[model samples]
Target: MRLTALGSRLRTTAWPIPFVWTVALGLWGLSREGSVWRDEAATWQVALRSTGEISRMVENVDVVHTLYYLLMHSLFECFGPSTTVLRLPSVLAAAAAAACVAELGRRLSGNLVGLGAGMAFGLIPSVQFYLQEGRPYALVAAAAAVSTLLLVALLQGRRNERGRWIAYACMILVCGLLNWLALLILPAHMVTLAWARPTVRTWIRWASASVAATAGVMPLILFSRTQSGQVSWIPPLTWHMLIGPAILLALAGVGALLDRPGARGLSATAVGLPLLAVPQIGLVGISLFKPLFVDRYVLFSLLGLALMVGVVLGALVEAVGRRSRSSARWVLPVVVAAATVALLPQALAKRSPQSRVDDVLAAAEQVERLKKDGDAVLFVPSARRDTKSVSPHAFTGIQDIALEETPERSGTLKGVEWDAARLRTEMLARQRIILVTDAGDVSKPADSPRDRTKLATLGECFRPVVDEQVRGRRITVYVRSASDSPSRLRCSESSR
Candidate 1:
């Protein structure tokens, strides 16, 4: 009796083990020696900005995920905004997501499937990257998992369960608010329910809840549309990249369908088809315009992929067992164990700490030492530049011109509009300006013609004071020429 009780307890407790592991790994990822990356730095800046300022900032800026910023604002208030503290919420959320994935797998398949999916989730390299950052991706990941589980539950139910319907509604609403990409799951859910032969009342309840949720989320959708207009330079998507996830998803489907036990054909079709098909179709549609087929956007699909693999593998083991009882008994466990062993190395490497925090802090220190109360410090284009080549490799705290203009390339700064006249006014007011640019190697073309003029103008107004090399990158400091006026320049209204 005691042994049976212990077994039951272990079965129940298995779901949370992966969650604990994910959290521990996330914490380790956070402990890595890195400063906040560009997007993370931008999130911190926005969170720190005053509410009044945020309205003005958002009007000109293109930020799709404002709720994440709002949450970060609350976190910053509570924890006082250190990089580690700032990222803790995302790390926690990612860990919770892994737990949810495990639970979903267990409910749909069995304990072995659950364990494999959860461990895979905790160890996935891409998952680790987002978990370590102070961004919305991790929260989006958690919401995606919850939304999927609720969706599966809603479809499987026979009657109108008020609590389940309400839960589904809330999950949908939260998913929409957290990340717009979550809308992709709605059609998948709908198709799954339709195929399940749910009762008429169930359909009505689901429809009503969905419509109500959409109404609630309409304002945010409108805000996203308005914000989209500000980003004019986003390039159209290509066909090859859009179809990539579909192929990966298809592999998962084959694994699931071929491995299922008797009478699983309908269940497999219901879950697998929509999960794989909708994203592929959506990707094709989205690719025709600006490509929204980013890997993280379809993060929810990973759950389906894992489920498909687990079911197929489980079936294979069961099949071998029927042929020979002794062989079958050990076959499944050995396969799973071997798969786990193969995956362990990649998992450990993903969570390693090497974020390069020392670089940004060092640059901040240098700026402090060089700056005086009245001295002007101008980012050449008045935008943040990539500082990856510099020691402690991270983004400098300089603001970017706007999100629309941010470069598609990673580890480089682009899209800052420089106004020479405006720069001159600020410099003259302070009697000197410390001009900083990313080391030339990583600096891309300035975003505006005015930015190029400002670079040329800088040499004319100031003499180089210090040209130091740190971490193989040159950082030059220039002091204003003696002939330049201490008073600020007065420009025409148009110039300003």
Candidate 2:
């Protein structure tokens, strides 16, 4: 009796132990990963660049969210711009999001529901992946959670309660600044509000505030639109990818409709709509135009997925209790165990060292040793023109003048035509030229054999210096004929 009473007292507290456990799990998963992949590398590069130069860089490149960049810029300034430092903000943001989910769950349902939702979020594979990445996706996820929570509070407002309205507006604006996808969450809000039957005056105030906020965000939308044109690799969007999320969403909707009055239906819709809408829209948009659907772009939806899963599990437990009251004791544990089993693979993958940015840096370091002074590194064939599909932007340690076909296609450097003579002349004027080509490009059968022979002809003009492996692919470096000249002298000193 004494032990049971103590357990009950502990469960009644605001900060339950299960909520703490869920947060710990999220933090652990995020900290296990150490790699800053390609897009992450691009984010780091942008953040490292001077704030004064950011607007100019964004004009030249394709960056959608200026606010995220600005926040990362500030973070880099304080943290000294290493991969770990660059990624820390996202990690913390994701952890905070898990906490917020639990808090929201507690407010809507009870401690058990909140704890389950938080744990589900913490264990999600996609959530773990984005939280460990050095990008804005994790922040977006956090903002989405905060926005959902605020919206819920607003819907549940009492007579003479104006504070929740202000809070809701502020959360929406902050989410909008975080990413354009925040706009996607608005339809969910509108649907929920219409179902809730709020007063006409409240609706008018919300709509007016929303219009003003949209007007405020117009400059950013224009800037993003201008940058979108530079991306040439966007693919068509499709409907097939929407099937799984859509089915799940329908189930969630049914669950909401079946829910008892007051908290159940409202909570179900709050979690279900965003999860269903963002990805469904994103995937469909991607099928039509390739630029739109990126896996990282839907990181915010993981929160909704977690919530939906938690609600379903909670409802299942309730159902089981109605059939066999004795089974209720085992239901929560069984749900947690099943979730852990499903999430094990993703949790382990996040911690693997093979997924790190240091691998690319190491490869670049190897290339550096073989080059003489006045060397230019050529990026052969070039990457996809779309910013969305471009290779991860992280640089290895090797620094060389990059060659490409179009500046728009390559994020960091301008593209140069494949002129062997011009390249040789540049190398002779300097002392060495290192040509790095993706082996996958070489395997393609469409290129003229003569054009394909460019590397061989260029190799003949210079001495083979070094060939290094980066992420399992060989990148060869070559020295110019005048390898012993003063240009080499300058190159040697500069490389050091």
Candidate 3:
């Protein structure tokens, strides 16, 4: 009687348990100790722009992230800018996602399953990484979870079918607007409807909702193509990348077998399997043509993995109860506790500044320390100007010698750069220059005429006096004698 009462109370309040748990996890290191990486730097710089400027800038580039930028603009206006303000939305979104996952588990299976899945969602490595990130993916995942819950409710013939369908369409539209790749969830839902063997009416309503959302996002789909070059840096899909998805699919498959599901009726397998497999397979199919197979793009699919894990946990408890009913109740809590212990190191590391690829703020601090007054600053390939854009105060006295126009004025992320001849002319006049670029491990050779000119002119005229690589950025202070000329110092002799 006592255990039953506890279980009933837990089910009644299941959503908050995971909601609070995930929020706590997200806030544990919300600021990453004031470190912001390049990707978040994009968010920071763009979010700080005025709405009109952001609108104009997205017209030329990054239209895909327009809604997110606009949303962040409002948040920045309301909360004054800081790393906490920047990342707190993601934390809240992740918590909402966890709450939705818990409710979905409860509806589809039972209270314990829902609670376990919701709590497990926070512990997943990928979810943990993005929970505190200043990006749109967590929001997309939260929207996906809500839409899936609505779909399940509709499948069960819940009340207010009409209103549920509208809410469902809105969530899907939100996901698509945030990222069109998220439209892949529609097919996953289609598979779930097929598995459930819904009536023709249900199929038609589902199709109508899905099509409406897709149509709403079609304009963005068409417009983003003009800005496709923004993703040109995403490497082609390879066998190495397949390893992670394959392992995930294998684990979900094990959960399906443990589920011992029927061919129909909204089993966890019916929903979870398709959600896990379809989007991954679909991404691979698209990558065949465009090579845009980044896992973060399809992050919503992690909910399916969480669901499958819930199924396994629930089944394990049930089997143990057959032998000893008294023992079954403690199984899940113990497993969760053990998993928490095992993940402690990774959880701590994820909160550290070193977790990201590079810390732009750390690099900015280095530039402040290494710079001399009146030093001319240059960003090789020009995009490295993001370091300066993000922390303009650090370069307060320095001149951007190669910049032709500011990023805002040019409606671009890194702004426009001077022509090659002008860049060379400017370099010749400077006695000392602060050259900022990527670290040696990640740096590529100059790919543009102007960037090549910057490097060549530096190698032939100046010698690197203060060479420091910090946090994935190389800030080299190059000095040249007033009498130095290309003839006096060869590019081969600089050793820079």
Candidate 4:
């Protein structure tokens, strides 16, 4: 009895060590990360604003990320502005998720499976990719994993424990709120529950929990629908979308390497198959019409893949040096370690600014070097202007000609734009105007709205002086044709 009690204590204590290591890895080099990604810049612009402004912004856009923005807002008020402060929540949430994966694995199999699964989750390149982000995807991944853990407890709990069931329902609702996309995991849970074939009362409890969670998430999805244009950038689904599922399947087959057959396989399949399939398949179905597919969107599903692999590896480890297990034991550890090393370079690159669409800091530096006091700036296609959002400090000496109100004042990521005529008038009044644009976008044969306006008016009114290309974009300086100035370029008179 004492030996059993000692074993329990050791197992419990062992849990957090892996959890802490996973978190430390996630948080590594976070402070040194340069040129916040465009998504993180969006967080900075929206979260630092007043609550009323944030509310107004979400009502028109990014309603999908409302809770995450509010959380960042609260953090900003308490800690002031810094990348670390903005992203620490994600780091902690991901750590909690890694730990939850371990705990859930232990419940399904044992400690060996739990430890291997948790470590695999921590080392997944995709997992590390999102954990360091300032956005809500990591939290989404965490919430999804935790909700699954809660479901496991609810399923196994005694009949008298109604409160655990209630907590499980509430947690599913919370996960949906974190990322409505997360609710897709529930269908997978439904499959698991169906496989259990519980008594009528158990079925009722499961039905009640599912209904409550669905009811809670409906309103969020409805509001998010109104702002659906925010994701217009997601191209339609293609064959590439199937690759995530393919990779997961390949990994699952690896776990089968140590399968004990029969009941072991069924149990693992019951837990693992649904997690790997339902969320992804549902998303793919939706993407058939909407193209909402991305690996990060279903990042939670990877935990299931990790758990399945861990179970097999654990079996091999436990049956050490016995018959076929002799070679399997040594091979499993080496394989896992080798897989992690293979992923390290790409994982490390994800930590650097190169992983993002553009280097906002580097572009901001060039703009600083070229601009004179009071120079006017116009960003072609407009959205590329997000570069300034992250380095708001560098544009102090210049003016945003098309910008009518700042992001904070307008309560939007890029701020409100003046009408085209007003923008043209503003541009003509300046001695020198700077153009910020993506290299490909700028070189396109067709003119974007802002591009057309800048070309039509600035073409007739001003002349290009000098232009240079930066990391992922181009910057040009246009000088007024020595004839266009507010004194000489007054709009009301010019129109007449």
Clashes of each: 9, 20, 0, 0
Model 3 clash pairs? none
Instruction: Give the TM-score (vs. native) of candidate 1.
Output: 0.77
lDDT of 2 by residue, 60-101 (tens): 664565677788888888877676676667777787777777
Best by lDDT: 3
lDDT of 1: 0.59
Best by TM-score: 3
Model 1: CA > 4 A from native: 1-10, 59-63, 158-160, 229-233, 259-269, 312-362, 369-374, 385-419, 425-432, 439-442, 461-475, 480-496
lDDT of each: 0.59, 0.58, 0.88, 0.74
lDDT of 1 by residue, 63-95 (tens): 456677677777777777677877888788877
After aligning candidate 3 to the native by TM-score, how far in Å is the CA of 213 from where it should be? 0.5
Compose the digit string of candidate 4's lDDT tens values, residues 1-496.
0122222443774458558967887778785355575677788777778789999888877887888889999999999878888778888887888888888766766666676777777788887878888888878777777777776766665454588778778878877887888888889888877765556777788789878988998998998988888888699988976886878877776675654433223354566668877888889899999978877788888877877877776765655534443454465468667977898798778887767666556677878888899898888767667778767777888989898887767766777788777777787677788888776533454345656887677676677888887656678888877555564444333563
The collision pairs in model 1 are 32-353, 33-356, 34-355, 34-356, 34-357, 35-357, 321-328, 359-392, 384-399
**Residue 59 alpha-carbon offset, candidate 1, angstroms:** 4.4
Quote each prediction's TM-score: 0.77, 0.77, 0.95, 0.88
User: Candidate 2: where is the Cα deviation over 4 Å?
Assistant: 1-34, 158-163, 250-258, 263-265, 282-291, 320-330, 353-359, 368-376, 381-422, 428-432, 437-466, 479-496
Cα error of candidate 3 at position 357, Å: 1.6
